[model samples]
Target: MRDGVRPPLRNHHEEAAEELGTTTKRDTINTALREVTARYRRLRALEEAREPAADGALDMDLLLDKRAYRPRGADSATDDHGTGADG
Candidate 1:
C-alpha cells in the first residue's frame, strides 16, 4: 500500500471491520472491497432482471413494487427508551 493513498477511516468502517472479524487494516480493506463488489453485482443483477428481453415482455408494475419482497417484522413504531421499532 502507498503512503497517503489510503483515506482516513470513519467510525462506521471500524464498526464494520469489527463485525466482519477483520483485525488488521489490510484485512478490513480487502473484506470491505469484496462486500462492495458483491453488493454491486447483486444490484446489477436486479437491474438486468428488470430489463425487457427479446420477447418484448416486461412487468413494470411488479418490478416497481420491489419493497414487497422485504422481510416484515418491525412496524417503525419506536419506543421512548430509544430502542428499535420492535422494542
Candidate 2:
C-alpha cells in the first residue's frame, strides 16, 4: 500500500520480473532469488535420490566407435597409400 516501499511479488519470477520491469527494487529481487534457489535445491535432491551414484548419474547415453577411435595405420608400420614402409 505504501508508495516508497515495495510489496512482495507472487511466486513466479518471470511474471514478477515482467510486472516489476527494469526498475525492480532489491527486496523484490532478493525474494525471487530465494524462491528460485529453494526450488533448485529441491529438484537437485530429487535427482540425487533417483541416481544412487555419488556423481548423480544413471543410464547415460554414450556413443563410441572403436574402429574410428583407433586408426588402421596403428596396426602396422605400412601407410595407407603406396609409400614404402622403409621410406
Candidate 3:
C-alpha cells in the first residue's frame, strides 16, 4: 500500500483478520465483502417480503394458520399445543 495515499485501514484490517483467522489481508477483505453482500441480500429479501404480494399471489393467512398445516401422520385430534379437544 502506498504511504499517505489515504487514511489507512491497516489496524482495522489486521484486527478483522486476526478475529477471523484469515491468513492474509486479501482474504479478510474478501470475507468481509462476502458477509456484507450476504447481509444486504437478507435485508433485501426481508424488505421484499414486507411488501404486499399481488392479489392471491400468496395467502398470508394460510401460512399463518398452523392448524391447517400439519406434518404427515400428526394426530388431528389435538391443537398445536398438543392438547386434545376433550381437555
List candidate 2 stretches off by more than 4 Å.
1-14, 17-24, 53-87
Q: List, residue by residue over 11-83, the lDDT tens digit for candidate 1.
A: 6678878889998778988998999999999999877875764345866666568676654555432443457
Arrange candidates by lDDT, highest first: which order?
3, 1, 2
In model 2, what lDDT does residue 35 have?
81
Candidate 2 pairs with clashing backbones: none
Which candidate has the top score in TM-score?
Answer: 3
RMSD of each: 11.1, 12.0, 7.1
Q: For model 3, how does the per-residue alpha-carbon lDDT over 17-74 read when each residue is reduced to its tens digit?
A: 9887898988999998998999999999977876655455668888788877665444
How would you encode candidate 2's per-residue C-alpha lDDT over 4-31 as one tens digit per residue? 8655554355567666463355656876
Give every collision pair in model 1: none
Which sections of candidate 3 miss by over 4 Å?
A: 1-8, 53-87
Residue 84 displacement (Å), model 2: 99
Angstrom error at residue 20, model 2: 10
lDDT (CA) for every model shown? 0.73, 0.61, 0.77
lDDT head-to-head 1 vs 3, winner: 3
Q: After superposition, how far is residue 63 of candidate 3 from its true place, in Å?
A: 4.1
By TM-score rank, best first, the candidates go 3, 1, 2
